[model samples]
Target: MSQVIQDKVIDENLKWSKINHDLIRTMETPGKMWWTAVLVCVAMVACAVAAEIYQYKYGLGSVGLNNPHMWDMYIATFVFWIGMSHAGTLLSAILHIIHAQWRKPIYRFAEAMTTFSLMTAGFFPMIHLGRVWNLYWVLPYVSDRGIWPNFRSPLVWDAFAISTYLSASALFLVIGMIPDMAVLRDHTKGWRKKVYGLMALGWRGDDRQWRNFRRTYMLMACFLIPLAISVHSIVSSDFAMSIMPGWHITSFPPYFVAGALYSGCAAIMTLFVVLRYFYRWEDYMTKNIMEKTCKLTFAIAMVWTYLNLIEFSSVWYGHNVYDKELLIDKATGPYAAVFWTMIICGMVAPFGLVFQSWRRHMPTMFVMSIVLQISMFTERWMIVAPTLSMSHAPHQWDILWGSVIEWAIVFGSFGWFSLLFLLFCKFLPAISTYEVKELCFHLKHEIEEEKREAEQKAKNTSAAGSQQPVSGSPGLEGA
Candidate 1:
């Protein structure tokens, strides 16, 4: 009897050759839509560059950086991009360690997302500085005047944390792609072959090479898990270490980490749908995988929501008037609309994932993921702006809605990130071929084993029935 496999991770009928051909074909050619996207991203990046130049020429005043609100949209966008970077570590390293086979098909692009987003995030700190040329002072180096970088400053911490995270994450991404690079080297021709060959590090896929690769990759993944956690925690310290009311919460580290993961997962969902649909990878990027992702995203969302509520309760019950007033002002102040948008989108919209149909529906999941990210962006803004807008010294209070240049740079960041990701997809293998083959092999073995067991059970039942006397013939006499 033919039996169906429930909740299949991938189409069982897929061949290894087909997998290679389909994935590599994406890099071999580009569609009109792909070119259109690239042109648009380039234009957006151009606008952002112009805005940055304009800002640099005129100084911070061009971006509306005023007293008490020095940290505005740029810092908020920085945090949002940093948070976006976390999903890659979660999917690639954390899930890899846990032996989640479903991650194999999607983790490549996710890792790419991590690296590109870090590149995007690293710019904001420098942009926030009125004199961007003086950013080198944040580096831990001896100055000509014998000045050392202030270790206590959170900005210094950001410099160290983000650089370290970017280095480790970039290494992780590149290391993970080496085997695939070898495949490309062997398959392609001319210049592409030469490039891939150099990148593959002369990988021959021998037993020794495989063994070493596994060890190195596993070690890197193990290192990355804690590194990812600490990076975001340090980022949170940028605020938590401050004396400001809302920014000084004890729970800010975990809160920030949760928010980071939440945003990252939402971003992954958005890209997942886009890649699956654009590449026509339904056979590999299956609904079951999407459902699992949705479930994980929903779980993270709930955790984020819990942390948010906990912050509110801590401030409300701690009777810290400054913190309480800031929280109230967020809900009912100049930024009330943005605050509520964050609440509705971050806290409430994730509930849509709890429904099975919605989670499996690509269009619905795509829309929901974008909504969640918008919510997360606003969340970072609320965290930075509201606290700055209201302080213990009422005389120093000011509201900053950000200026056109600030908005342009913010818009350009998405374009920058998208351009990098789009280019990466056009050139590299976005899906891991060997890992997906392994997944298919193991799944096939499992199905065959189950089929054998079912056949044996059926045989035993038939033999027992035949051995017993027939009901109408000799069963009554035998009994």
Candidate 2:
């Protein structure tokens, strides 16, 4: 029993030492590329802010919105950002539930993505309301007229769904970080230690604490899985519930969900690739893991393609002339190039996963993931723009080009997300050092046990050889 205790203590000491070394390495590494990413993100955000200022001073007319097309790029970008947020939650929650060991290294980064992307997404609905100052109307509260938000409205549902998912995701992220926070707290000396200490929630390496932590984590995983699904579905319903030709489809909810997963997976893959390269985590984020992630990307890509086909097929076979024309416009009209590009990128590109070489190749996987993301963005654009551009009234048919200000805001939003993630990697531990240590310990014990078994087998074989007659000596005597 004493020996066991001593072994555990030594194991923990070694673990902490390794963690401290990694922390120093992360801090010392001059992340020039990370700085460049930060600058680009900042520039994007600045443009977005400038656009907002122009819109606030001028009016809603600054954007391309009219009678038939009330919702524009803002709404499409909002949905796209929200869908991007779903990837992190899906990767973290699903992997946790399945007890995937590889997830230990990647979940922290993915969870960070979820939180920051959701924060960026939350900004859109408010900005889209034009009178951003009157955003309080969406809140569920008492009014002088004593009326509540309409429960039947899909918009209200979106408000609830996004709020719930965001809160739950935040909680899950913090909870999962407790152990790592404790590690940081212990390793740091002054102010950093104090900050991390509070965040660690007074975590102690005790059995009872671990038991509670495990139970709470399991519950959060259960909650997050369904919450993510419902959030995207509600966002899709915002379009589907509308009477617009392209928007009024029963398949929107599931199709949106699949697209969300596809894009989310792609974003996560991109993050993993970047993190692995920048952090020197070749051991943690191995080719094997990348291969597995690509397989998932391929699978979700197929689902997205199927849904696209289903949506198009229904449009083609239906008797409604309006819907038929809308479909025709999407295929051969002004947006045909974007529509075809989305198909080739989202559908055809991912088919490369069928080849074993492509799955294992890092550069190929990274390029494919980027292409998939761009395609998903185009898919969202097609959903919003083409429909609005080709309204039922021929006189109302107008091309909605994104204004300079609009472009800035959109670019800034992307910057905002990237900046947060890049800063997170720089200051905090990117890979969970403590979790990696635990995995190493587990692997070490497994190897030790195998070695012992092999040694015992060798000893047995030697004893058997001694007990048996020497075949060569016997033959020589007989001769």
Candidate 3:
């Protein structure tokens, strides 16, 4: 048995080594379209920087904020981005707890999206302040006035929740990358090797190191599950706690969480499709993985749809004059088109995944994911704009449209995110090479074990045949 185990180990190592060689060669080859993508991302950043400078020179008045609709596109975009971050934590932490093998390839990119989206989302509240210099006043720290931030304020809760989530996500990203960083360190040379070597923290594939690493990762996964849920809940509370019409529903927390996960799943799907094709990870990120992702997106999209219906029903049935009026205005007023589009894109189009073909086809799934993301953005806009537009005062019921500068900055944020992701792929192993190798090792062992069992059965059969049936003459004489 000991010898059998040793042989199995050797076989597994050889199989994994071959796979690693193939993976290295594929990743080393740059695609012809890579530079085109880089150029587009650069142009987007430049456009965004110019727009931001213009906003700074002209002031917040240049954008779309008035008496009632103070929180316009910027706030909506912020919420959308923050919600997008939830997918990473869900995939990494929650799925890890459940031991989903498919998550191994997807989790790294998802976590990166979470970290970058959180960073992007952090910018909005500051930009919304307009007088960004006084941003520190939002903190609970001691001020010259000797007053703390209102403990009961939802905005303060948002500040605390977002900060905590960002910190946790950063830590999660670093921890997840450590093993892969060690792989890079082993494979690289010169400056790249030194950088990865330092980041790897002397990981040496020792038994003790593996035990501790797994323990740390498991603990982090446990912590992140609740953190991800609470972060989105807190974000929802920002509006739910408000007494404004269309905002005070009890369903807001779960609704927001669902929306977050819905958009997040879509974003993950989009990124996975891109990465699978761009990195040529057709073997690792299989059709089955894409189908599973789409299934999740469809499930969450249905939940979001149900929540929307419930929200509308509760408001309509309660017969609160303010809530009814706001609902009516949102459904029939100037923003009616956006509201319907949100429903169709967010809730309706995602139903396409019910078809087996749609789930299997990467391009179709990719388009569906993009539509879901766009619709989710529209949902965020609906949440913020409709309430702020149709306030208690009749005279303030003006439609708020984002300025050109606002659009530029928002588009730039996407550019920034894409840019970071692209650079990450170029430098770091986007798919965890070591993790894949480990899986390959396990698979190899399983295959070899089956082969050994089959060989043993064949040998036993041959021995029995020779002993009982080789010479029929002696057996017949005895009979």
CA lDDT scores, all candidates in order = 0.91, 0.81, 0.82
lDDT of 3 by residue, 1-479 (tens): 44444322122353555545544554454666877888899899898889878877778876666567677888899899999999888888888889775677668889888999998899999887788889988988877878998988878988998999999999988987887778778776788789989999998889998898889989988988788888888888888888988888899989999999999999999998898887777776777778878888888889999999999999899999999998998889999999999988987798799998988899988898889988999899999988888888878777776778888989998988888888777776666666666655665777788778889999999997877844545564465
Which 10 successive residues of model 2 have the least lDDT summed?
4-13
Best by the TM-score measure: 1
Which ranges of candidate 1 are over 4 A from the true structure? 1-4, 461-479
* Per-residue C-alpha lDDT of model 2 across residues 1-479, encoded as one tens digit per residue: 23333222113234557655765577544567767877888888888898888888887775655565677778888988898887777778887789766666667888888888899999988877889998888888889998888899999999999988888898988888788778778777678789889988899869999899889988999989888988988999998998878989999989999999898999988988877777776667777677777888889889999999999999889867888899898889988998999999999989888898988777878898899999998899999988788867888888776777677778888988988887787766666776667756765676577668779999999997887777665533454
Ranking of all candidate structures by their TM-score, best first: 1, 2, 3
lDDT (10s digit) by residue, model 1, range 298-332? 99999999999999999999998898999899999
What TM-score, computed on C-alpha atoms, does each candidate reach? 0.95, 0.89, 0.88
True lDDT of residue 338, candidate 2: 85
Question: Which candidate do you rate higher for lDDT, 1 or 3?
Answer: 1
Winning model by lDDT: 1
